[model samples]
Each structure stands twice: as C-alpha cells, then as structure tokens.
Target: MSIKTTTLCALLGLLAPAAAIAQDSTASTLSRLLECKLTAAEVAAFTDRINAEDVQDFAHAGSDASGDAALSLWKSDAPVTAWGETSDLVHLSSTTEMLLAFKVTPGQELARGKAIVDRIGGMAPRPDQAAMEATYGWKGMDFRKPLSDNRNVRVLVDLSYSPGWVTVGCAYGDIQ
Candidate 1:
C-alpha cells in the first residue's frame, strides 16, 4: 500500500470501535494523531486547570462525566508538553481550529515537538463543525538550518466529530 493508504489503514486500526465494522477515516486519522498515552492524574490536573480558568475559546465535546474523564486523561497523559511562553488552554468552537503555540530553543525544540507529534498523532479540519474565529501564528528568532535560533512552533489541531470525539494535531516548527 502507498504511504497515505498505509497511514489511513493504521489509523483505522487504532480507532475502530469494538463491534463497529464501519469506520470514519477522518475520525481514525484524528484519533491516531492524539494517541499519546497520558496518566489519569495528569489529565485531571489539566482539565481542572482549564475548567477553573474558564477558558472558553475551544470546543469541548465532553461537558459531562465521560467527557470530563476523557479530558482529564488527555490533559494528564498526552505527549504534547508545553514549552517556553506557551498559551494557557483556551476553548474554541471545535478542536480543529484550536492552535497550540510555544517558544523553544532552535536546535532541540522541533525535535521535541516532532517527538510529541509522533507520540500523539495528526488532526484534520472538521466539516460539520464551525471553524475557529482566531488565526494562530508563530514568531521565530535566530534563524539557522537544522535548528533555528530561538523560535516558536505552532501546532494547529483540526478536530472533527465522527459522531464521536477525535482530535488531530499538526505542527509548524521553526516559525520565522
């Protein structure tokens, strides 16, 4: 199979729900991107922090217990770690439109971010949901090949609801 096909197949395998033969390819892709393992405590802490802070810029599917629990898991155990000058969690209309921005040292930041992305997975834009109002951008400092000088990486998560919840993340590193 081609690389795209292989990726889609792997994604489908990872996200196929029990007893469901049919799968949403988009959902599968999104889920695979977010497949980073997270600890329950970490998820809980992150969720609690977002909740307490009342971040209303992102869309949250889980407004209930299950959602809360999932959010807790996502926050705590996920591989996407925050680095220098990261934004506080914000709520958007959908996950796809939300962007994660952070500053890091040039040489290591992209690798670090890529590692996180590899662990977590990729996301695509949702067709049914409303897009985000804000556009996310990053600023880079000290440009260099292989590792740019002090720069910011911006990750945009494209979330779509396949009658369920799935989040996909895409990152643009070494923003200059």
Candidate 2:
C-alpha cells in the first residue's frame, strides 16, 4: 500500500474502539520496530513530554489489582541497579493498563502483574516467553534489556533495553 494509504488507515484506526486502536497501534509499531533500546533521557525525549502522573502510574492496565501492585513496585525507591532508568517504560498503547517490565528486579513486578491478569483472564505464561531469557540471559534481560521479565506471559520484553533484548506487551493484550 502507498504511504498515504497506510497513514489514512492508521488515522481511521483512531475511530475504532479505544481498546482496539491502542492494541493495533501498539502491535504494529512494535512489530515494525522489532527491537528498540533507549536511555531514560532518550525515552523521555522520544515519548515527548512525559507528565509526573505518568511516572506515578508507570505500567498501568485498567483497574486490575495486579497493575496496582505493579505500580507500587514502580513507585518503590528501588534504585535501578542497571535499568535504563525508573523500571518505568513509556508505551504507545491507548489502554491505561500497559506495563513495561521493570529491570530493577527480575519478575518482581511481572509476577504480581500476572497474578492480576490471572484473576481477570486465567491465562498462564506461555513457553514462547522464554525466548527473551535464551537470547538475553535473565541478568541481561532485566538489567540490560528494555524489559525485565521471566518470559511467563504475553508481555513483550523486547520494547527497550540497555544492552540486552526484550519484548514488551500491553496488559490484557499483546503488543509483540
């Protein structure tokens, strides 16, 4: 399709249900980018003017309990050992419930987040999730990659990282 056509389609996408559009843009953008890495400052710059509330919410997904717990983790003063900064990832999803793995601790927030998802969808982490660990060791996956996860759910740990690979996903959905 021509660039104009593609742009028009994306613009039209905005008219769809909020959830659908967010998921669509998120998936398409990530699929096209494949892998992305950036520093805290870089991410902030790329994300435009990130608000203070945005930092507070961090990885949010609707009104799920797990997302609440995950937000607590993000709010914690855990000095990012080797993260891109703030275990906070800025996503392109329209859904309020989106989280990027926090590398401050492996599976720290993911576990809690999954618990919330389970309560909602009753789904478990897929085996394919291990791809990140294999490609970027757990250490690299968390501390170095944009997302720090144990490869247990639909979360994409490949959104951003410092030195490793990760794939990040949206809450209640998939962005990879």
Candidate 3:
C-alpha cells in the first residue's frame, strides 16, 4: 500500500478498537447500574445517613408512593443531615430495575439523577415492557411514543422479556 493509505489504515485500525471499547464500557456501565448491587463499602458510603425506618418502609412497601413519602420527609424543613435510601434495586426476569431517591442539595442531586436516567432511557428499546411483564414472566409490551409532557424525576424501569437483556423502559417524574 502507498504511504498515505498505510497511515490511514493504521489510524482506522486504532480508532476501530477504541470505538468498540467505548461502546462496551457504556454497555457495561448500564448493566452494572441495572444490577444495582452495592458493595459493603459503597453501601456504607452512599447510605450511611439513610434512616433505618425509611429503609424498612421501602423494603416492605416496594412502591413508588412509599418512595415519595420517604423523599418528602427527607426533604422537609428540618435539616437533612443524611441521604435517604437513594435506590431500591429490584431484579425481575433477567433484568434489574432501580428505584432511586436523592436528598436534593441545591437541586443538583435531582438534576444529576434525572440526567443519568434520561441517558439510560434513551438507550432502552422501544415499545417498552411493563414491570408486571418482567416480574410475572408475562409477554412484553410495545410502548407508544413517550408522552411529551411525561417528565418525572422518579425512575420507572422495565426490562425486556424477549431479548431478556435489554432495558425496555425508564420513566421519571418529580416526586408528587
């Protein structure tokens, strides 16, 4: 090959692997976040301030409403010296769903969390499945286009049953 072609080929070869690595890393990060398994140290660091009562309620209730209540109490007028349970990661089928709450600080925490969810949701497949489908091993769902006004901060995740590995839906709304 000519010198120019040789150099171009070498550059393309270098770039191809880098692109593949980036895609793989993104996929891996999504997988890990979906799994939602926190190390002992990570748990301690992230949830030390979360109240025992809050965690108990979330574990027992296992509903978005319960999460909202806990979030409200945490964000009450009293100083929040602690972080509420940030996420309750639930696994159904071969996929993981995460319920996250942040003790908003100067609004950054909530905004950051929203951004992350949006990014992940964008990668999910269309016609999203429902939580019931994944949990009960029912058929998958095909969602209509995302509602234009459906902006919420709470994450509602559904993993696909057919592919059985892709995240199908992630919805968010503000804690009401």
Candidate 4:
C-alpha cells in the first residue's frame, strides 16, 4: 500500500483501541499522543490489544530492538473533536529522547495547537497570534513544560504553519 494509505491505517489502528475503552475519546488519545506519554510497551502491544481483523488498514509497523524500543511511528485518520483530521502522525523514541510530530489540517492549527498546549500543561502567559508570528516568523510558535512529575522528562508543544504546511505536536525527553 502507499505510504499515505499505510500511515492513515496505522493512526486509525492506534485510536481504534482507545475508542473501545469505557470512557476514552479521540481527544484523550490525542492528548496522550501529543504529550509523548504512551510507553514503548503500550505501543508494541497495540496490535494484540486491538483486533487487527476489526480495524481496516491497521498495521503494526513492528519494532526490531529486543530490549530497547527502537524508533517507531503511527499515523491516523481519526479526527479530533473541534479539530480536523491530521494529515500526518509520527512517534519517535530513543534511549534519551522521545518526540511526537503531527500535521494538523489547515484552518484548525491555531485552536488545536493552543488546546494541545493547554492539555500538556501551559506555558507562562500562553501563546497568542502575535507571539507566534513574531517569534516564529508568521504562523509558528512553541511552548514547553517539563513534566512536573518528572523534571528529567521535559515536553513541549510546537506549531509551525507555512504556505502549504502546518505541523502541531510535541517532544519529550532530555530536552534543553
């Protein structure tokens, strides 16, 4: 299958299992994903926890590292409430760092990005239109909040918007 098709399936596959939970919602899953909160083990068990037979186009892009979780990514077609469907989704993990990156559908970048910043824990004063444009040169801004529970695991929410592309996601790990 094409990369786009595969990516879309992978993301749906990721969310489908969450939807089955008693009270889980797409926003909940999105929050966890944006925070880079899902552990390697949880991600690995996705295929088994959620029946592949039921989710269309779902594929567990399998990992190879035995003890350490190698870099892995999951894409989706699931749309967030108040936010449009993501164009792309990615997750990366290493011994010292983990990052989640996703491209938000146009027109919803600002609201979605702000909501994500709030969900992950806000930055001082919050970010606004002028701030994003001034700091990031039009349609760009980033806010970081070190996990209060774990100072070592810092996380940040970033939004980048350009003529034809917009990415809103987060990164966590040994970030400076």
Candidate 5:
C-alpha cells in the first residue's frame, strides 16, 4: 500500500474508538434516563443494559413503615466512560418515585449536569452556583413534563459535591 494511504488508515483506526467513547459518555446515559418514563419494564431493561444486580438488603427510612412500602435498589460499578473514568451507578425504585444516581468528577459536575438538563423540554433556569454552594453542599433544580395520561412527571436533579467525590441524582415520578 502507498505510505499516505497506510498512515491515513492508521489515524482513522485511532480516532474510531475515541469517537465511540465520546458517544458513550455519562451525559448520554443520563440524558436517556431523563427521557424515560421510569416504568417497571423500562427500568428492567436499563438494569439489564448496565448489568446491575439487585440490592437485597437495601433499606430506606420508611422501608419498614409498611410491608409494601419497601424500597428496591440496584447498583453497578461496571466500567463505562464518565469524566474520563468509571463511576458508581445506582437505581432506586419505590411506590412513588424512581431515582438514578451516578458519580461524576467534582470539577465537571455543573457543566455536565447542565448539559443533561438542557436536553429535556420545560427545564428550569440554571440555578445560581454561588448561592447554591453557599446554601449547602449540593445544588438542586426541578421541572415537570406531562405524560400521555395527563399525569405530570416531575424531574429533579441534584448535584452533590463532597471533598472527594461528586454525585448527580436524577429522580422522576408522578407529580401527584
């Protein structure tokens, strides 16, 4: 083969994987979840995609309040591109809500979180970062979208930054 052709082929080969990794970013995953209705079947498919295992012992403050009021959780640490590294992913389902939480690198949280927020229609205005940080260790915003049955799905995004880690939680369910 000609030298020019061979070098071009090699460069293209290197770029292919980089392009794939960028498409498979955490932001994309979160965007997909934001679009989801969080139905039981949809949740099952998501867990299968991530290979998340059931958390048999998972419990929350109200888990014991009643027999059917228990919370269900699934978690996976499977390596996927996020902030140039892998981060923990958790899914929680309860009678009234579904939540997806994943960790992103501290410094990139706001920019990345906002990107996810921008994808959905009717999103709230970007919260003030300075006031948010001053008020607490996390920043949160909320918006609601109507579903086919006329019920509204309320979505909440919370970005929590601690000394060593940053976690972004997205929760959605019937507004009522």
Candidate 6:
C-alpha cells in the first residue's frame, strides 16, 4: 500500500480489469496455512492426520541432533514410518521452518500429495507445473508459501523419492 505502488495501481487501473488486480496471488500466500508454534501433541495430530508416526520410538538417538537449537515441535533424527511400515528418516523438521515427508501407500503419491495441500488450502495455481511434474515417474515436488502475505514468513513442501520408483514419501516445509 505504499504511495508509489498506489500511484502505479491507479495508473494501471484504467488499462486493466479489476479482476486482474484481484488475481495477483503468489506462492507466499501459502505461508498463512501453516500451524505456527507446532507442539508435540499438535505434531502428533499432524502426523496422525497424515497417518505417519515420525520416529516416535527413536526420536532422540545417538547424540544431540538439534545441536542446542531448542526444538519446539517434534524431535530431530526421528525414524518416520510411511503407512506404518519401513521406518525412515524424519520428513517433518522441528523449527520455525519445516518440511514433512509424508508417508503414503503404493501409487498414492498424487492423491496423497494433493490431500496434504488441500488440508492446508489448495495450492496456488490450482493445477500447475507441479501437477505435470507429478505425472512423470517422480511423484515428488517442492514449493514455498510465505506467511502474512510476506515473503519473509515462508513455508515449503518437498516430495522426496526417486524417479520411476514407487516409494512412500511426500515432503512439506516452512521456508526459512
């Protein structure tokens, strides 16, 4: 809402439809969907919602994985299980920013991935390149969403897996 921006908008107003101005949405809009200040219970609920237990049994193993970072939600180096099978590394990070490698069943990547995004509020662009990318062998993806309409407060999601390989891994995160 700055003066320069306002003036520019006004000048551009006579040339474009108001719908064009209202359609100015970006990836940053995704940030507002994250549940900030994630807690253990909340994290559990989040995992449960996605139907994955992120290394709850061995969340804190070996040495200090956080390095005195003072985690707020979930733990680091946890063994996350997809669809309750084959324990893997933590997909969801514990911090201001995050990334959730959502677990899914065979051939469930596209549907499952969409479900996660839908839970938050469908991604921007409805069905864009991300969908086309998913159509390929790799059912993986990465995206960013900034909070409060500010690019500074960002959230990101990354689908981790291999090409031409069927695996249970959908990633989500908050961009730092």
Quick one: best TM-score, which candidate?
Answer: 5
lDDT at position 29, candidate 6: 16
CA error at residue 122 for candidate 5, angstroms: 2.8
Report the Cα lDDT for candidate 1.
0.31
Per-residue lDDT of model 1, residues 1-176, tens digit only? 79999999988887656314222322232232222222333334433545575423322434442232222111211123232212322223222222233223434554544454455334222332232323332221111111132212233322221112222222223222
Which candidate do you rate higher for TM-score, 2 or 6?
6
- TM-scores for all predictions: 0.21, 0.25, 0.27, 0.35, 0.37, 0.32
- Ordering by lDDT: 5, 4, 2, 6, 3, 1
Model 3: lDDT to the true structure? 0.33
Query: How far is each candidate from the true structure, as Cα RMSD in Å?
Result: 18.6, 16.0, 19.3, 12.8, 12.4, 20.1
On residues 1-176, what C-alpha lDDT tens digit does candidate 2 reach at each position?
A: 99999999998787656655554444333232223322333334323423334332223333232232223212211221111122323343433222343442444544544433444353444444467567755422221122332122234333233222122433322322
Instruction: Please write out the lDDT profile of model 5 over residues 11-92, one tens digit for every residue.
Output: 9999987766544543355344434444545545554544453322222323232223222333332322222223333334
Cα lDDT tens digits for candidate 6, 75-125: 332233332223222323332333323234546655554554455452443
Indicate the TM-score of model 6.
Answer: 0.32
Local distance difference test scores for all models = 0.31, 0.35, 0.33, 0.42, 0.43, 0.34
lDDT per residue (tens digit) for residues 1-176 in model 3? 89999999999999988766654543333233333333334333323323343332123234442232322211221111111222333222211123333323332432443445555453333333555566777443333224333321123222222122112222322212
- Which regions in candidate 1 have their CA more than 4 angstroms from the true location? 1-96, 121-176
Ranking 1 against 6 by lDDT, winner: 6
State how far residue 54 of model 1 sits from its true place (Å).
Answer: 9.7
Residue 98 lDDT (model 1): 24
